[model samples]
Target: MVSRILNATVIGIISGIVLGAVLKVIEEQTTKKVYTLLLNIDFIPILNSIQFGEMGEFLFHLLFSIILSFIYMSWTEKSSPNSALAYFVKASIVTFPTILLYFPLSFLALKEVPAINDIQSIMFWTFGHFMYVIALSVLVYLQQKKPRS
Candidate 1:
């Protein structure tokens, strides 16, 4: 049990780092910004505003990945190799709570810290969450396909 938890944590952190790097690259290329959720509030500024040096970025990714991993595992407790579609189902299930919780929280946070005083900014941020959901789905699918030894 301890080993499983430890493995899950390590995997989560590593996955988070990878996902964060990819997200960072996407943000840089598209000039999009990312925020961190704080106290059920999105407190961080646009990704571009942050110094987000290499170390800071890595830590951000690592922490998020760890959290995501645990969420994934918990949501898919009964999933197994025999259930090929289980990953997609679990991914969809996971997305619901995130969208419900993060959307309003993010909207309020952004409203409080108005990066751009326009409707487009709100739309873009909301769209970004959709993209994140897709990414999470892909990540969960990939992880499920990994061979266990």
Candidate 2:
């Protein structure tokens, strides 16, 4: 059990790093800035303007990705190896709330309206988060398909 959890955590961290990279790529490719989630880090006293106001954001995204991935991966292990379509449906339903989670966190941190500032911004958030979930599903599915060591 401990080993499984450790493996899941490592995979979850990988997923989080991948998610962060994907978002960064999207930000670079798009004209609009879509990763303003870090702007709300003022809520954390110790992280105030961490690493000259950059590392905090990266840490936040990475940490959140790890957390979400850990939960999903652990849960996936318990579930039967269902069809790909069913897995996707389950993932989408589960990960569709990236915005919902972000909004409140940002609001509490910034004391102002957060998330969905515009359609473009919201789309970016959705795209990044859903993509993360899809990636998790793919990894888990691949693992399930592999022969046990």
Candidate 3:
């Protein structure tokens, strides 16, 4: 159990960093604010009032990634999909709901996040999440691989 949790944490951190960096770069290049959106907590009531800098907000996002890793690990442990496509599909299934978070996050955020109905931002968010799904799938696949002599 301890090992499983540790593995999950490591995988989560790696994948989370990848996703965050990708979104950050995209936002920087295009000035779309997807990265800011990714770390937004303005809907969380009291927590929203405090100013969490980029690193702090990123750590907060990583916390969620770790939780998601734990959940994904447990789920994969049950069925253990064998193929790349299966892994991709399974990860997509798990990650699909999170892609919808853009709407609510935009709607409730007090900060300068993208508008709720902004199609370009929505597409960017979706693309980022899909990249996240790919990272999750690939990492999970690699983790499950057995070493041989």
Candidate 4:
């Protein structure tokens, strides 16, 4: 049990950092407006502010990633399934609730981003979330597959 928690925490921190970099690069390379609005819930003023700015957004995701990993790992104790498809299923469990929470929470933390915005923006944002799931699920699956030390 302790092993699982420890492994999960490690994986979560790694996942957070990797996903943060990926998301940042994607946002930078492609349309900044989409991922910026989707991933960041910082109020417009803070987001635009000279201090903390983008770092604030990255840190928020990293912190949540660790917290979410603890929650998700706790649920994966019994009869471990270890397939790619299974990973997707587990990740979906994490992803859906995250999106649901994000929509409402965005308003509280930042301005309410219109969910009914452009189709491309929504699509890319959703893809970014899936990318997050992919990173998490892969990390979890890798840890699970390793021989218990």
RMSD of each candidate relative to the true structure: 6.0, 3.2, 1.5, 3.8
* Clashing residue pairs found in predicted model 1: 16-65
lDDT by residue for model 1 over 21-132, one digit each (tens)? 5445545565544334212222455764666656775675466656766677666655552454566566556545543544455566642432444454345544554555
Cα-based TM-score, every candidate: 0.53, 0.76, 0.94, 0.73
The C-alpha stretches of model 2 lying farther than 4 A from their native spots are 38-40, 49-53, 105-115
Highest-scoring model, TM-score: 3
lDDT of each: 0.53, 0.64, 0.87, 0.66
How many residue pairs clash in each candidate at the backbone level?
Answer: 1, 0, 0, 0
Tens digit of per-residue lDDT, candidate 3, span 1-149 = 89789989998898789889888988999899889999998789788888888999999999999998888878887998878888888888888888888888898887898899989889988888888899998988888875634
- Best-to-worst order by lDDT is 3, 4, 2, 1
Model 1 CA lDDT for position 90: 64
TM-score of 3: 0.94
- Position 87, candidate 1: lDDT: 62
lDDT (tens digit, per residue) of candidate 2 on 1-149? 77666766666667666666666676678744545552356677876655545565666766766677667766677787578776676667667777566555555655333344556756776777777777777776776667888
Question: Per-residue lDDT for 1-149 in model 4, tens only?
Answer: 77766877787778777666665666677654544554555565545454556667667776788788877666654646667678768777876776565445444544434354455545655666777788888888777677876
Where model 1 places Cα greater than 4 Å from the true spot, the runs are: 35-61, 75-81, 99-102, 108-149
Ranking by TM-score: 3, 2, 4, 1
Query: Candidate 2: how large is its RMSD?
Result: 3.2
lDDT of 4: 0.66
Question: What's the CA error at residue 10 for candidate 3, in Å?
Answer: 0.8
Per-residue error for 33 in candidate 4, Å, reads 2.2
